[model samples]
Target chain A: MFDYKLLAALAAVIEQGGFERAAQALGLSQSAVSQRIKLLEARVGQPVLLRATPPAPTEIGRLLLNHVQQVRLLERDLQDQVPALDEGGLPERLRIALNADSLATWWARAVGDFCAERGLLLDLVVEDQDVGLKRMRAGDVAGCVCAGDKPVAGARCIPLGAMRYRALASPAFVARHFAAGVTAAALARAPAIVFGPDDQLQHRFFAMLGGEGGFIHHLCPSSEGFVRLTSGGFGWGLVPEQQVRGELERGELVELLPGRVIDVPLYWHHWRNGGELLASLTRHLEKYTGRWLVQV
Target chain B: MFDYKLLAALAAVIEQGGFERAAQALGLSQSAVSQRIKLLEARVGQPVLLRATPPAPTEIGRLLLNHVQQVRLLERDLQDQVPALDEGGLPERLRIALNADSLATWWARAVGDFCAERGLLLDLVVEDQDVGLKRMRAGDVAGCVCAGDKPVAGARCIPLGAMRYRALASPAFVARHFAAGVTAAALARAPAIVFGPDDQLQHRFFAMLGGEGGFIHHLCPSSEGFVRLTSGGFGWGLVPEQQVRGELERGELVELLPGRVIDVPLYWHHWRNGGELLASLTRHLEKYTGRWLVQV
Candidate 1:
């Protein structure tokens, strides 16, 4: 098998794009890095690096780099477990990414409770569910709770649960714009609320309505802010059942589409090597959300 | 955070249930495994494994194992990219889990061709899309192609595409059972071929018929067998469009429900570490299956 250390050194060299730069970054002699590469090529029976003005990875080199990264992540995970050998020190910090809606609703509170109980600190990054993986890819956070099934490279994923959405409007807004049943044409004329430019629920709604135009839309990025905007009669929006249940019961928000609700399956994605912190967080979230999210 | 090595050792120990067995499996001395466990406990500030009887992972230990496994996958990925420092063989063989249908259809051929070009070999395990994660959890495979949004803990996932299923039957079977327009009652008497005992396509069809019963099913474990059984006048089955398109054109099989087809979304799951071979394999699969599987 390939020597992991040597492969790592070669990766650093390729990433730095030159032996000199990679050697400096790795605190190794340039000649040593060169020799390492030579040895590697002999073993693989192919040239992994193309030495030129700027060093570049051959296709094989790219493959090796990918492998090296995975090994590194595994190593890091092993390192994390070393701390569990004792119980005296403070727990290590965790970093996570989540959608705004989940953050505003029960997710944050649940995470806070977990952190407090475990004596762990958490760094949270908020983003749209569609783009949460991007943050994870950039290493801005170690894990993410998002809607998509796809995980970024080098990250582990799990199913927390699904989030249900119901079409809702403030009683006043409904009274103004939806006096008649929501017809294909009438919906196009009504005002609607969207989470942001990237939000596609409204688009999906229109598609379900046979691609007819029906509504003008207002953009609200924050989950809390979106709720407020809808409650203040800005427009109709799909609200999470858990978040707007009280409003619906209190007659503040009316279910526009009572029988037909949308369900977005939510998943948890994290660096596969993220350790105990992510597991605890995932289990806790699943325990609570399992009761709420749609089964399947 | 948890130390990955400690967690891995703990998981292995728990799986093996003895220091000797665990050490043998891990290629380490019994003393090394013992030392690693001690270090792990110190780091986690809790007892991760109970030494009574066959060793078992504590809740905390299980949690740590989840993280460590994910990281290890990532590390493997990283290692794949680096060049070797000495003359040695390629890294360890890659293990993968794939949906039965994908394996039987074009995917197997595509993957085989790619691996041959790259001088890599893969160990493949066939599984249903729904249960592929369980295999990954048991460490049976390093990655999987499954049909769900949620991934197993410490595994990275991405959307592979979709598999479209059309209700199909042999011409002879259709002539005998479906001469009359198929209704819920008519379907109940018809014999159907299904992928396995856990196959639910027929149930889904029944549910769509206002909860009426439809079709008695014959379980076939192989995707290719399911198609052949249906085409050879055994029963009707929901077959992938790609798999049945040729047969349908040849009048060997006929569509039962032309407009109403089931669309199953598929996703790719693997250890998150950057493995070059895995990445290249994934890219090739994605490119080949693009539009062939789903619109995306």
Candidate 2:
């Protein structure tokens, strides 16, 4: 069994980029910080940090850092529940990965509020929903808000809600490109906006409409750019309802498929044994998700 | 050795997200596409293209795909030199990754012009210079233009030049925040914009000015957002000269350090065996980079 204090010290050294700074941050002597890391490495039979200017954690060290971060979150949760243990010394951190759509729209505000209220720092990584789960599996994050319900071993998969998406185009774009209606031939000739080459949402929407044309013609990988470009009449694109809700309501963007919502289920996957903090976060996420997302 | 045609078919299936469509893309029957992929997998004694709606390549399969993409680029390069082999069937594609700063500013137009002239499809992935190299190492990209001189084992590294950066803030911001003068005490209380947590540019500038404060106060991961936020007087940042050259000229953004330029050297890294196509592409990049970037 690894000592929590040692793990914390190792995390500090890697995160602070050196021992001296970590010592200052931790309010411990530099000698103490160095001794703790050396002891941890001796126990693990491997050196933790690759000594460089702003040292990087070795592979084994990264795994240890992940564990330490998870433990730190859990301890903070415990401290909250047992208020007597709250020293109010350092703020805890929650490491999570989110999809770009969520980051660009309603979810950013929601997560920001939650983190603020809980007095937690968020280390959020943005990736595609399709690829976000890879980070969770690699131990780079405590949890990941990603697409699909494919559960991994040793993780709790909670279906948050279905994020409704729709095909949208500016009024002029529909008139210019799809004057004959959004038919197979029309779509084949029309340029479409895609997040990236791997983005499957647009293709999924097209397949639903009984037509699959070009995969990626106008690539706007940034989520904000995707919304603006599609809304500016550059091309028709499948965009999250949350992102285009204002545009749709104001008549700035017209829905290509009226009343047809392609629902992609989002699942919050976390370590099954991740204690009360993970449970509390999951509850908050599920509640916030239901307010904004369409659930069946 | 892996069969190039079979590997091409595999890439199409993973990219297009289905066998039927990969067949459509390759102008082959669905059965033929499946047969080619199966034959390649059988020869390698491993399954590739994990069965999903949009099929993903298995780890080994991804390796094969990367190799195939590299080979395709080289062949296209060869065809250009030996014009007799140009039957003019399909346009060749070049997969590359670029830093976002370069993309948002000057390099996009340049790359587009070169690709148009050469009749090559440019698939560009935007990532920070630090992380962009990982994509090249993983074979997700054929080449990368990124910061630093660290060359991959099998790749050639050419120093394009330094990308000069300066600490910039709007006139209003300078008047408001630095009325007390730019000192360590004042800076410690100032809000600063950073690309992300791992971004060290702002801190590097601060260190150079003999001050260091909180690393991340406001995070704006988008390069375009960073420039806009810094220019809007939200916070100070170290922005690329190429990106903010116009803003500096218009006096919309004032440089904190007039003559001090933080020069980050950018290098073009590609496979040593990438040959003719890579060579031609490098020349174009060098030309464009020189036009917009400082070569000394």
lDDT of 2 by residue, B4-47 (tens): 77888898787666898688777789999999989988998989
Number of the top-ranking candidate, with lDDT as the measure: 2
Give me the runs in candidate 1 sitting further than 4 Å from their true place: A1-296, B1-92, B109-113, B283-288
Model 1 chain B poorest ten-residue lDDT run: B83-92
TM-score, predicted candidate 1 vs. hidden true structure = 0.38
* Native-to-model Cα distance after best TM-score fit, residue A285 in candidate 2, in Å: 5.6
In candidate 1, chain A reaches a TM of 0.68
Each candidate's lDDT (Cα)?
0.65, 0.72
**Candidate 2 chain B least-lDDT 10 residues:** B212-221
Q: Find the candidate with the highest DockQ and give its number.
A: 2
Query: Which 10-residue span in candidate 1 chain A carries the lowest summed lDDT?
Result: A85-94
lDDT of 2 at A188: 60
- Which stretches in model 2 have alpha-carbon errors above 4 Å? A13-38, A44-67, A77-88, A113-119, A130-143, A149-182, A189-198, A212-296, B13-24, B27-38, B41-67, B74-90, B103-119, B126-140, B149-198, B212-296
TM-score of each: 0.38, 0.68
Measured by TM-score, the strongest candidate is 2
What does candidate 1's lDDT look like per residue over B226-245, in tens digits?
A: 56556666667788888767
